[model samples]
Target: MPLLLAFLFVSATVWVTRQAAAARTLTFLMTISTVVTLGLIAFFLFAEAIPVFERMGVRILLPLEGEMWDPNTNTFSLVPMIWGTAITTIVAILVAGPLGVAGALFISEIAPEQVREIVKPGVEILAGIPSIVYGFIGFTIINPYVSSELSTGFGALLPIGVVIGFMALPTVVSVAEDAISTVPESMKSGALAMGATDWQTMKSVTVPAAFSGISAAVLLGLGRAIGETMAATVMIAHVKELPQPAYDVFDSGETLTTLIAGNFGPAVGTEYLLSALFAAGVVLFLIVTAISITSQYIEERMKRKLGGEV
Candidate 1:
């Protein structure tokens, strides 16, 4: 009997080692594929955009002043669109960050087990809903409300920011909940045994322990808001110029993603216009890429720290 048990144990060890090696190989291959794909995309974007600089000179599109993106007038300043993207993204993050983290904490720590199961799926379902549907809701419901209450036209920046913030909420909550769940149960138990209240344990122990993951989730949400297109295009007033005070959230404006999606088809006929749009694409790409890289780095660092590899 003893020999039979030893033989089974050895067999299980061998099987587990084989599986681990296969997983490592698969991960390496996937990493290489992703890097190669991103490199190709970057190369193509630059190749398409270089022509605009050559034909019109960088001064035409990049001048800080006298830069209006009037295609008819041959002016292609991107400052307004850039500012619009920044404002909308910043506002969305500010709104989504706290709500998402709180929702995550509720599900992971405060909720009953059965309730957590129900709420988690609902949050994930929100992420799966089409972006265009969210846009439609924003256009039909949010726009009218803002227009009526604020006595402003539809497509104001505040409504767009709020809508995008909602769109990003599911992503932040899902990721943050997963992170909070990964915290060791023993830590929570120890805190409670040491006379800490449930809320105190969660606030001091679980949240701080999972801070990196929560931050990564927020950054990911920000990236999603920054790159949203159809929703922003439909909901935003789509003004091509900057707001009067430049910080006015009540004014309508354009983002890079919205600008590219809305204008790419019509601009295709003109080489310089197409190239200029490609330049905008490059900018959006770089921003999203940077956010993604930062999120990934933080996640990896957190994993290492949790695994005691740091």
Candidate 2:
């Protein structure tokens, strides 16, 4: 089997990598293999999506008011889902970014060794919780609470976004904490030596120093939120229309992930619906890839800023 050959090849390559020359060669091969694998996936995804575009024209990518995503009726507009994904992800990032950064700062700069020992691990443990559990919490508690108290739809945007934000929080906290920890003590010491208060030094030196990594952490959180399936599925209704008023976070909606996830059983052999779903997948891929590439650029710039290079 191809998998067995790949496994044996990898094993033999790893053995050969015990020598320095073959190690570099094998590393290059591995990197190329990964890149090629990703390329193939992207190619196939786009290829599968082409049928929808050809059948429906580019109207599939346009915003709503006309057609909503009922594939049984052959309507395949993607904008409402895009809007849902964007709104929820924006809410999630807005919630997670500041909180995660603050958590990171507290853990890296303010917490004593014993406190860091406890809190940091506790935060990381949150990352291990199954996302489905978060979904259940949202569906059971937050959704009903919002529906009762706020008098909104049970599957409102704000509550679902908040749940996703909290789900992403531990990742942001962990990565941002590492970024803060990477800040040289010398920089903080210099600020202190200049008669800066600890708070002032942290505000001026540590945060700025760690800003890019923090930024990347936030982007990663956004990516997680955008790609989230189980939580979004459980917490939100599968409505395909744009939210009434468009600005109301209390509106029920479908997200890109939930769209793909929710329709699979029904979409099994239906060409247009399947293709539209794949097209959604393609869009999701592009958006996430753009975020990842931007994060990488920011990280590189951060490295240059920290390294005393022009």
Clash pairs (backbone) in predicted model 1: 155-237
Q: What is the C-alpha lDDT profile of model 1 across 1-310, one tens digit per residue? A: 9966765676567557897775666577669868998899999999998877676676634535654776775667777888999999989998889999999999999899999889999999999989999999999999999899998767988889888999999999999999899899999999999999999998999998898889999998999999999899889877888898889898888899999999988997798889889989888888888898888888788778867896
Compared with the true structure, the alpha-carbon lDDT of candidate 1 equals 0.87
* Candidate 1 ranges beyond 4 A from true positions: 1-27, 55-67, 300-310
Off by over 4 Å in 2: 2-18, 308-310
Task: Compute the lDDT of residue 113 as modeled in candidate 2.
Answer: 98
Q: What is the alpha-carbon lDDT of model 2 when measured against the actual structure?
A: 0.90
TM-score of each: 0.87, 0.95
Please report how far candidate 2 places residue 164 from its true position, in Å.
0.3
Candidate 2 structure quality by residue, lDDT tens digits, 30-100: 89889999999999999999989998788888874566777767878998899999889989988898999
RMSD of each: 8.1, 1.8
Candidate 2 matches the true fold with a TM-score of: 0.95
RMSD of 2: 1.8
